[model samples]
Target: MKSPSLSTTAYAGASNGESSERPPFLRMRGLCKSFGHVTALSEVDLDLREGQVVALCGDNGAGKSTLVSMLSGVIEPDDGTIEVDGQPTYMTSPLRAQELGIATVYQNLALVEQRDVAANMFLGQEPVRLGVIVDRARMVDEATRVIQRLRVGLPSVRTLVGDLSGGQRQAVAVARAMLRGSRMLLMDEPTAALGVRESRRVIELIQEVRSEGQAVVVISHNMEDVFDVADRIVVFRLGRKIADEERAGLQREDLVSLLVHGCRSEEAGER
Candidate 1:
């Protein structure tokens, strides 16, 4: 498949409450997006802590895609700031995001159907040994080590991503991001099309990423997925943040109420 034309976003984020020792994974404030006269995202603010999983949820047209695009550098926000690793920086493109140790696994998975897992893992950025030849052996070894590091349960490194099961392909896609030395992953509905077991495996892989201390921004519509893995839940309603709850006291329905109705009144009362 043709890779999406990736570019870096021009806006840079902020650094707040982040330490000198620890890098600020990502920060955003007053993020806004519009096309013609239609506002897609407005005044959206987000902070991604290191090693934490943040679930970004909203109904369609609620600004999830716009935020992801800006974060992943698919499109620039009309207004906002973005900071990475404690430094204010602009993600001018997907490659620039990669340079900042940020990687995004889009909903489509972006695998080349004709290639094997190793090739897929190193797509666009292939390792070289003798000037122009790919470091085939090192690529395989590193790919193997990455899957092992993530505790991924793929049967073989030689498996073609296309031939693998849906969940396995998701694993490959995520693994590719990890192998590129990404410190954070912005996943877009990773389990949207997978079977139960496949989805479960993908969940486990995400856990492994967090265990390794890399922050994650997971965008999913599945409550189960959110409740199973998120450290924080940020719900958006009509281009605005309605609720930002820690996993400690937040319920699925409470977040749903904020997302679906933008009303808090007594979301906890239902429980």
Candidate 2:
């Protein structure tokens, strides 16, 4: 499978709740990372626009984790520049990325099982009283508002996170990220361990997040999930990007071929 040329103009254009003049929500150019003699990534460039779900697909060891790791500030790139809203910035730590409106929701979810939905939603940034106290009422109200807005279908904000289903728990994680005014969400295998119905709920959640005008980068191996929710697909192989195409004209088989056999020797021979 030959790489599809990415359209700069298409990516630069405005989408729902996003401004055309504003720099792309997130942009990376000439990104490179290495450890000793192993090159994890080389000259990788990527762009994420507000209100779009771009799925990053690849087999294991394809550098998908490395790319997301750098974006989440877990590790610094060996060479490259990162830009947010058109301004060059350094993401030296995960906290810095969160401060810059970038939030990462890993597979573990990092939610406290003992806490309820509202409590988990505003865990660290809980609203406080005049002096010093957690404003329980305000927290529940805000949590309810976000849940209703996203239509996540939680029974109640007070329900314990541990009691909620897998999809519901994932919803809480996503809602928590949104509470911090995050503009872009990096979700890792959100629906990995879910059943059909639960996976559907999570797929709906991803769409709802995109509808809210937040840029979303979903790292997924499930072809069904990727095709169902992604506006674009980016395929990486052997630490390099092999294809970047809009989901409209892309076939699942072609994507699978690229993943299993980079550049597809049979197809290359025919060409």
Candidate 3:
């Protein structure tokens, strides 16, 4: 399997019909990371525009998680640079990533089972009144507003997070990230362990988020979900990026070939 040679300019001009004149909202250049002698990522470059939904697809150990970790500030790259909104930035920590308008929703969802939806939404940065106590009233009000804006159906903002269904819980997680003013969202298998109906709801949620003009990087193994929600597809293999192209002209089989053989079907025959 051969990794395609993709330059930043070539990626920007890919046939998505998006204007190449507009600069990407986020850019990663020559990102590399290694643990001891094992390289997790190598010279990977990616560009993302506002309101774009990019599906990161690959088999296990394909460096998808590693890349997401770097973007979320869970780890630092051994060599490379990250640019946000045309400014070079360092994601030193999770808090720094959030401050830089990046948020990550891991597979665990990270919601407290005992807490209500409003409480979980504003967990660490709960609103305070007069710098003395937690302002429950304001918290609920703001939570209600964000929930309504996202159109998430729930009994109430006061409903316990543990009581909500899987789909509803995923919505709450995304809503919480949005409330934090995050411009980019890194979601790890958001629809995993969900039923068909629940998965549909999550797909809708991703679409809604994209419509709100936030860039989304969805790490999903489900090909149907990728084709349904992604505007572009990025395939990683063996710690290298194998393919980066718009999703419009791509078929599921083509993506599968890339994931398995690291090349298109025709190219596979040549190899």
Q: Which sequence of candidate numbers ranks them by lDDT, best first? A: 3, 2, 1
TM-score (all chains, Cα) for each model: 0.88, 0.89, 0.92
Best by lDDT: 3
Model 3 per-residue lDDT at 92: 89
| Pairs of residues at least 3 apart in sequence or in different chains that clash in candidate 3 | none
Q: In terms of TM-score, which candidate is stronger, 1 or 2?
A: 2
Model 2: lDDT of residue 219: 95
lDDT digits (tens) for residues 207-271 of candidate 2: 78877888999999889888787888898987888888878757777888888887543464421
Total backbone collisions, model 2: 1
| Candidate 3 per-residue lDDT over residues 1-271, each given as its tens digit | 0222222223324424655676787899999999899989999999988778899999999999999999999999999999998899898899999998898888999999899999999999998989979999988999999899888899899999999999999989999999999999999999987888888878878777877888899999988788777888999998898888787667778899999888888766522
lDDT pick, better of 1 and 3: 3
Q: Rank the candidates by TM-score, best first.
A: 3, 2, 1
- Give the alpha-carbon lDDT of every model: 0.79, 0.84, 0.86
Worst 10 residues of 1 by lDDT: 4-13
TM-score for candidate 2, residues paired by index: 0.89
- Candidate scoring better on TM-score of 2 and 3: 3
lDDT of 2: 0.84
Work out how many backbone clashes candidate 1 has.
Answer: 11
Residue 258's C-alpha lDDT in candidate 2?
82
* Candidate 3: stretches off by over 4 Å: 1-19, 269-271
